[model samples]
Target: MSFRHLPSRALIASVLATVMVSFALRGQDLREADAQAMSQEAYEALQRGNAALAVREYRQLLEAHPEMVAARANLATALVSLGRFDEAIAQYQMALKEEPDNSSLRFNLALACFRKGDYLQAAQRFGTIHNGEPNNVRIATLLANCELHLRQVAQAIALLKPLEKSHPNNLDLEWILGMALIRAAHPREGLERVQKVADRGYKAEAYELAAVVYMGLTDFDKARSDAEAAIRIDPHASNAYLTLAMLDGYSGDENGAAEEYEKALKANPQNLQARTQLGIIFYNQRKLDDARQQFNEALALNPRSLLTLYELARVERAQEHLGTAVKDLESCVHEDPQWLPPHIELAALYYILKRPQEGAKEKAIVQRLMAEKQQHGPEPSVTGSLPPSP
Candidate 1:
């Protein structure tokens, strides 16, 4: 009668049926004991942070009692704790089917979707939850994050503004709102919001954000000061160094920018932004070897990054390695066909290499993409260069 003896699903179902029926007909507490014990064991495993064990126990319980919403919910939670987002999503869906009105189960499902990088589904689910509970700050924040990932900047800002008003001085909300505003092209307003946070004692992150805004505004001196202040507050803040490097590049101080980028990388070696920007600075300086090294490292980190590929191609072209440049540009174009810059560059390279037919093909694509871009308004500049002075 050991629980482990019930190996097959049919066996588990038969045993569960017998246990329930015997308990009901005989009014005997003994028949119900095994079922309660298994549930308690699952709870205890979860309490002890053994998510794998908890998942196993919950799954066993679920197989025996497929209609038990609590068991499904707990299994979903255990799967989430184990970083099994797809499985968690399935379990949560099952729990929701059993209890359609369960807000927590729906939220968990949305969270799993978000974690799995399905921003569209996450946004839809979070939007539904937000509609049901408009005052839920957590849901609003998560929904805004999904919107941001989907490049719905205006919608993110709209969602965050009310939360900012209701929860004044809340650092996370203010920070997100400020970033949303900046992304929405309201840098002045964003800077003011970030400045307010900094003045209110969130100096480190606030200063770093303000520095980025100042850099976008082309106020190099102010950007430098704010970035320095961020570094002073937290020397290991990789973003502060990266910002300083970008400001230096904008100010035509390539050497200083390179040094700052190195510092940023030292603080956090995985910072692809710092690596990419440093490569751009080196490329601009005509230091092809240095630029190639940085871009190659960045490409290793993010193989499909079109910007890195383009920059790497540029370096190869500068070094008169036309073949390598063509290969890189081909890869870049393959990754993003509508990207006009790579097509433009590739056309020129083809013409230079005496490949007139290939050149003409790329030129045609360039014209089409340019026309499409004009019809849709200008694409956002992803060149990582500083904005022109006003």
Candidate 2:
């Protein structure tokens, strides 16, 4: 998802519009001819798509007339266009101190934070603006998306339901609301909303979302059908292929699963699930070198991925690289303290390395997790018996 979708408008255009509006000089007493010339040059640089030049000119302009609020705001916009979000944020903050009531500055600030992956901060900024301008659909939508990213499914659902009710047939809202509902374990209602988008020409994304819901329901046939529809709409629908591959694996057709995973990678080489699962297949077949290669490639794609780290540690352990495996597993354990798989594997590795005390501690945690699972009773897992071929 964005930083995933808006109300069917290009975000870049919005950014440009903000910049154009903020380029108006507020006529400060200190605004001299040199400062004006620099501002004009920076504006032209941006108009000509020379973002680096724009940044340079803006910085120079600000150095001369530090109190020029328009220059500061434009500098932030220029920095944002150059993908220097932290610099943009700093500029926005400084500009806000001068004109604290400027909603446009706050809006741009929220967007910069979103681009920087600070969803919580973005949510806070957007929330404040939304509160003041209760009818601003864009800020409301953005706030809902931030909630979605933070896994605040209940809040996202609550925020979106009224929006969808008021703004009937907004596919973007429907898509976002459907995601929240599905995450809240209301698959049927989510499927209904997503299907509306599919019927209205947002076929690929809608069908892909539907396939995920069906997969969760363990309705492999419907999942495959929806996934195939998505791929037909857009052959680059990597997640659809990923769902298909997962279905194939669950069906016990290893060769089919591998082929589907490869198809997924061909569609999107950076797909983490496809590469990781394919590596697990290789590991199960005892192709240690191939598995190791895949896991390493997966990690290279995203070093912060705890799943990939855990999987790579498993391969290292299988290859008898005990010490290397321990380092990776320990990192995983530190990052994902509540996850049972990493803890379980780390416990085994500790015992293998003859760290009996640490191993016993990990074993105790695993025992506690098992006890919790038992108390919760059996949750529905792989809800269907069979995965049919597409």
Candidate 3:
């Protein structure tokens, strides 16, 4: 129902006219004393780390006083503490309508979106907030983080570069900016910052990043050393394990690579790259079912990943799901016309499906892409290596 339709609810107030009331009295249609006591109890629940109890109390309080913005914001915080991020986001959003300029509500909403992996949404909100408060290091750092997660390397670099100049010795800013620099293909500069952060005790993450920088520089020995150091500092360093796996795979030690990949997944089951790489291993081993499972899991983590989509399409085709494979391959082609691997796969599929015309069209695209590649020579890999040569 439209909120304007509820005049009775809107007009219901404990005091006939009071603009300078207590925080609790702002929205609840309750006597001042009762509102104070109830809100105080809810606040205490939050302070005591009893979010479930706070949620219950806040729900009861909001029931009789649906317009209570303060109470609703507190309720949203409680929901976030209890890992109910979606519920928390809803409450924050509703409260924002009542007080559109509430920074706390907007911050919490962005935080909830970030925690829920909606980095794009979180980035937009954080960007606005950061623009308004240029000196707010926390907000700027978080916005940079969101950019990194979204693969907007240039944006992240722009946000962090100025911060690095202003706060030269801050390890947090240095490490993050280092990562952005590396992604922006300035590995030599990136490595210097990462080394400083590592020397300053952010060993695990910095070492992991240094390993990647070394890989890009083709210093395999240094890459192995840094990766091993990262793992020693934190056994649960899944990315460290992933780096070691890549090293082994590149060295032609398939068994060692598989073991490292397994360890990486065990440390972090949600590591999408680890899952996808292991799936490729299974594919090379001719274990179609296992490869399919891993590809599907990676897709769940990032449904729009053309790499995963193409991998899954190959598995589907091998399993004789030609129609499904065709759809996925076509989607990949539409999403990235210049990408050659999917075109090659689609050409083979079209031929198998007895569509000579479509196959010839795909072949033509592949030929054009190859010509462009030859003219351009080969672009350097951004992070260590390219996708496994289709």
Candidate 4:
């Protein structure tokens, strides 16, 4: 879930272009003299970080000589630099049409798709490249990331397994593979992978991931230890304290949970999850004012957050602000119609407000959602929900 440690696709593309430009152009048919000169100027603009100028020049060159594959490819890279992913995708596709076997074109196309949030297409393209070049660890890693986002955990694990064997020291591979395993309900395997990374000197992020894996396995003591290790390695890691706080809450230690949550917020004030969890603790303890403060702060950070709205509604209801609570609940339900808890809560509130028909409608939705949950298995707890007591 954390790509923070990985080199960005843009950086990867730039490096690839630098290393492979000559190879990519080798044996290609020559463009006209004017087109070739314009392409060189565009490439120089790109090198100078003048992405907009590069894009304009490339577009003009492509307009004059649409068959110029290198110019089209360079245009795609410039568009990518500008964050114009859809435009970049178009240019890459056009370039690929001229040279379908070109690996660099295919890779850049896949990266453009990924940036556009078209993960399915990106995965398919990356998979095609991987099939042809299995030793390309970067492509494999990116393909695994696409699988993780698509929730194809088994596929991600399968994709990374052999690579992890060949490149045992790749901490990013281990981190992503561990997370995929955890999401696939193989927490023990995930824990082993993360712990191995931690033992290999990637203590901070590795221990943080290990703590989350332990929490998934319901090994609170181990989770606490890993969290503490993560904190000791990097005190500014807000996730470490958040994991510790979650462990504290699960163990019925509200005070300890609150303390850790506060520490987490202090470490990273923008940690919305920590603030939301702390608010839930306050709500459970009947500290309505304290709960509202945390929830309001979270709402200020993300005004459209459904969990914050739902929690803030609870606070408003506890304080007898019926109108405000109703408004908040209505907004929550509107934001996520299939969320069962809000429907149930809204139904009760509607009944109290003498809106019998609306209450009945909400209650029916709750029944349908509950039946669906029964078929699928238990729903995962959302933010602002209390942890099950130990």
Q: Which residue segments of model 4 deviate by more than 4 Å?
A: 1-45, 48-50, 60-67, 134-137, 162-164, 198-206, 218-222, 228-236, 248-256, 262-270, 284-287, 297-310, 323-390
Ranking by TM-score: 1, 2, 3, 4
Q: Pick the candidate with the highest lDDT.
A: 3
Please give each candidate's TM-score. 0.71, 0.71, 0.68, 0.67
Please provide, for model 1 over 1-390, each residue's C-alpha lDDT reduced to its tens digit, 9 standing for 90 to 100. 587864799978999999999878775465356667888999899999999999999888878778878888888888888889899999898788878998888988999999888899999999999998988888898898888888888998999897787798776677667777877879898788887787687578788878877877777788788888889988988888988877776678889989999999999887888999889988888888988999999988988788998999998998899999999999989988877899999999999999999999999999999889889997564323321110
Task: Give lDDT tens digits, candidate 4, residues 192-292.
Answer: 88798887875787887777767776777888898899888899988889998888887789999999999999999988889998999999999999999
Better by lDDT, candidate 3 or 1: 3
Q: Is candidate 2 or candidate 3 better by lDDT?
A: 3
Task: Write candidate 2's Cα lDDT for 1-390 as tens digits.
Answer: 674455546777898788776665544423666677789999999889898999899888888878989889988988988888999999999999999998889999999999888999999999999889877667777888899888887988888787787887777788777777777778899788887878786679788878877888878898999999999999999888888888888889988988889998999999877898899999898888988888899989989989888988998999899999999989998987877898899999999999999999999999998898899887677532211111
CA deviation > 4 Å runs, candidate 2: 1-38, 64-67, 198-206, 232-234, 299-377, 382-390
Which pairs clash in model 2?
Answer: 1-4
Residue-pair clashes per prediction, in order, are 0, 1, 0, 0
Tens digit of per-residue lDDT, candidate 3, span 252-293: 998899899999999999888888989999998989999999
Model 3: worst 10 consecutive residues (lDDT sum) = 381-390
